[model samples]
Target: MFLKQIVHFSKKSIRLSYQFQTMSTFTSRTNIVTGNNEWIFVDNDNFDYQQELARSAFADMLHDHERNIQYEKAIIKTLQNLSKSMKKIHILDIGTGTGLLSMMAARALNQINNTSCSSRITACEVFQPMAKIAKKCIEKNDLSDCIRVIDKRSTELDLENDLQGDRINVIIAEVFDTELIGEGALRTFSEACKHLTIDNENLHIIPARATIYIQLVESSVLQEFHTLKNISQQNQRINIPNDCRHLAGNTIFDLNLNELKDSIRPLTKPIPIFHFNFKHINEMNNFTEEKILENIQCNYDGRIDAFIMWWNLDMDEQGEIQLGTIPVWCYDDQEKIKNIQWREHWIHGIYYPQESKIVKAKDQVSLYCFHDEYSLYFDVGTSPFPPRSFIPAILSRSAMAAFNSDKRRNKYIKVLEKSFSNSSIKRCLYFGDGLLLPLLILEIYPNIELIILQSSNTHLNHCLEAILLNSTIKLNYQIISSLDKNEIDFQTIDMILSEPFFTKSILPWDNLHYYYLIQKYRSYFRSNIKIFPQKARIRCLALEFNNLHKIRSPVKQCCQFDLTPFDEQIMKASLNVDETIEPQSLFEYSSKKPTLSSIIDLIEIDFEKNFYDKIEKKNLEILFIENGICNGIAFWIDYELNENIWLTTGIENENDSWINYSKQGVHLLPKPIYVQSGMKLQISTGFDFKQGQFLFDIIY
Candidate 1:
């Protein structure tokens, strides 16, 4: 519970007080005040309130025990090595999120010699809100005397004033994202080496060196996310021209390595592409350097769909202590993937090429890797180009790729083919975001009259472009923003075709935009008008996925760190917001672990009936089909193209028709529960009419 008190002093002064309820889960103190305005009227210089109440991101970091354990071991090793030197150890810990490393260093030094108080640590946290928490953590661990929390980014720290004119002997920093250098680590290291850390032989960096590796793989499953696909065994009747070239690249693709290990097939062995040696300051140039790996022979005969990448860290000087992010299948011991030591902070990376490259056994290719300050780009070719500054290509290759997907084109072809079979439906009206439907309709029915209603002039121009480029058939179509009832005749329109999609659709239910339009235009259509999709339904099922729950809630602790504080902070920040439930492709994340319940229908929408009416709340009782741990609920939409033809976005079966082009959405339970066979689970679900969103509630 949270309570606020407003105390009004004279008209010019005010004091606002906030009291946050104590979290018993972690034994946090009661009546904790995160922010108060009492000091504002007195002195604001020393007044610092917690600015970042959201702690999910931080909780995620603390959940990685592999990272925490390795850092502890590294810190211990560094302190043991420094003990041999007569000079006192001055450690500079940068980007200390929880002051875990500083506390570890202090604990290690204290264990070695209780009488010696020479070693000191200065932990720097750029987020002042987080810095205060780091200070609390240090004090909680009884190491406040040895480690001092500095509320400033490393770059902002003045060496002379902040460090008391002292050069540091050791530097420990945790500041790398999935892209490795995405967090501006290059600049941080470049400056720290120049001004902060001593350039002496005794200086030691916790992570001595790091190396990035990449391999080519053939994965149609992975390509489905980046490019278009056609999965039917039969030949497609309609073909969208594919002419887009790879334009650019972005941050690394972080995923559950264990889930994708068996899904991807490799064409080449993992190759080391870049290495950064933190001990040697000059190695920082790897961020801006351009390099080429030439004549790499392909080991397998297959088409290379993507480049999978991972990096390993050498934590100690002897390289005896190291941390690797390689997936379980990559290791000799497959059990490692199931091990908790496999961390989440750093997962594998994937770089998708503009087009799939066909490679035969013994075939050789060259890979060119270029980088600017904070990102890496890869280009595959037969030879290397001269080193030059990186320039991002400006193109709509992604949009073109989406348009060229086979599965999507197949849906359009099947729908139009099935609808055209009705002899009475001659003229068609298209209402959608693009003109792809207009072009395709004209291709099949060359003599059919098509009228497209596009709201944006920009989209209308695109339609003209598609028509201009593919002029095989002269289309009888008119583009209009809206139908003026006074000036237009609606009697001739006998058919309506739509994708039932909207640009504002972030959630699956947002597709109601199409239904809302139909509700508004139902009276304008002829009595016998036929809609493309006859009906739509919502279906759901209870599932168990251990890895999926880890993203929503932490099941592992980082060493001896009390991560509950961070978890509590995050839960409070997200009290009113539904951040845990999200849209995901169940096809990519299915478990051999048995499901608790089969698919259950939660709601149904029959386009034949009135759908614009207020949605009535639904209460469902689902019996367990099998005994298993139920972690969440998976839901999807089913669109009935015709009476006999159906396209679904739900969980796909190996034997089912491979025409599901839509991704399913998931709603994770607040906590996982083990249900026995025949047990009934109660759930209530409905639509938030005002917010245009879906609401789900699980009752025990």
Candidate 2:
């Protein structure tokens, strides 16, 4: 005996229309109210009040049973106008979303059948969570004989052979999309129509056509939203979350969707990212696109929630528009929901454009909207026009380090900028990385360019793949398990050393030659290297080895320095701590001591804030690229004489503790390399130390 009211109105046009919601009797406590006017409402009074407000059956969605009943009456009126020669009708309801549209269609068929409605109905749903609830509502209505609910999608329609019949004459699909591609409508309905429909014999509720319209919008809220605080502390995007970790508490003063990304079920969900209606549009017959040109309006004020639209079918005017609904449940723990002063249950995003002057409604706009994501973006076109402009976007932060120095970039910037003016190079290769100088170079200077990232770790392989897919920047990287960019097999290095390469010709790692020079002097290394300096010399001499520290001794002490003749007792060190603890268990606890370098590392963190302020103000463009799996990353940074640029990398295997603890870390250390190709090498650190004088273009 419950009644509800529903209103049917256009979300885009804001036009008032006659859509009513009338609820039919059901055994369940909640009743869905669909209006002949345009609103869809549902009542869940039986559910706990708090539950409805929190995550609940009704989810605080607005509805009325009486309104739903009236809407059903209007739907019946529309169905009656469709055909004249049928006694009974079979219907296939898609998305059965809330079970309201299907229910309306069922009630209308019953009116035409006289006395009562007894036509078969099949509801196809894909989400297990949604399908379960819908099945209960269908069974509670006592329409089980006529309406059968299946927990599946239209793509899997073959399993619903029982729902198909020769006399079946109606397919009521309410799955249209504003931009036919955003919602799951096209994928679901197209497949269903191909298999389940009876050609042009029966009436399709909304068979074809979706003309998407769009224009630029500016909002201040969007700018502020993009400035989210960094949590993990890594200066890279791969460190981003794969799940909804948190939500904004108040109105976002700013917004930015360009960098906001997430993995989800599909686009059918209409992820509301920024709000803007169509200012201009061009349409194709069915599911077409048209661009309304206008200036890009960005905000210094309010935020943008997401682009919004509602797509409806022309199959029957009796059917109402299936408006887009924001499923706020996508966030973790409902962390995304927020409340305003006037509305308690209504959840709204910040994309409402405040000023209309941002983009004119009549101007032709560019269609290459989401251009920065490495897509094949095409600029807006004129009638019978070939698309204008094509290039890729999405630059890596690593690639721009070169241009970070305004003072240093005077010459490089001019070279890159001038090169882009020719427009002859359809594709160019970027070699370096770090601050994404290459990407900015491509953007500032118009040219088709590709960037190759070289990495020694597999950690960024997948992220790099996603970056290639989403950004305008292309990737040429490798995913290898270890260092050795030249594909130098360790076995080969071992083989070469074993036969002709000579035992003394070990590939220099960590400048071990310096260690050899230090060991020969014997005076400095004898003590720490052996503790008993004389014994250390004897061991080194007897072993005929330039380096005794690398060799495991019968002793318990092995330090960074070699023991010379000047020291006391020889401290035989053991690399295997577990093995050493057996002989000296008591000493092991106090002896988990710091090495020389570790002792030097205890200096309090240098809060050298703004140390690079001068360098950061530069307009330089640096390209950093890492060849993934195949080689190392080509990351770079603006060169500074006073500040040292440290290069660090993390591999996928860092997730393991033993591998991590065993010293598998950044391949390139904080060594000073040359700054510019034309500049000479200045003595930075290693001239007197080791690693030899770094010889390069600025050759001494």
Task: Give the top-scoring candidate (lDDT).
Answer: 1
Question: After superposition on all CA atoms, what RMSD does each candidate show versus the true structure?
Answer: 8.8, 28.2
lDDT for each residue of candidate 2 in 494-565, tens digit (9 for 90 to 100): 000000001111111111222222233333211322110011000000001111111122211112112121
Worst 10 residues of 1 by lDDT: 27-36
Full-model lDDT for every candidate: 0.65, 0.29
lDDT of 1 by residue, 279-350 (tens): 654544655877888889999899988888777888887887887776566777646645735445666677
Evaluated at residue 458, the lDDT of candidate 1 is 61
The stretch of ten residues in a row with the least summed lDDT in candidate 2 is: 532-541
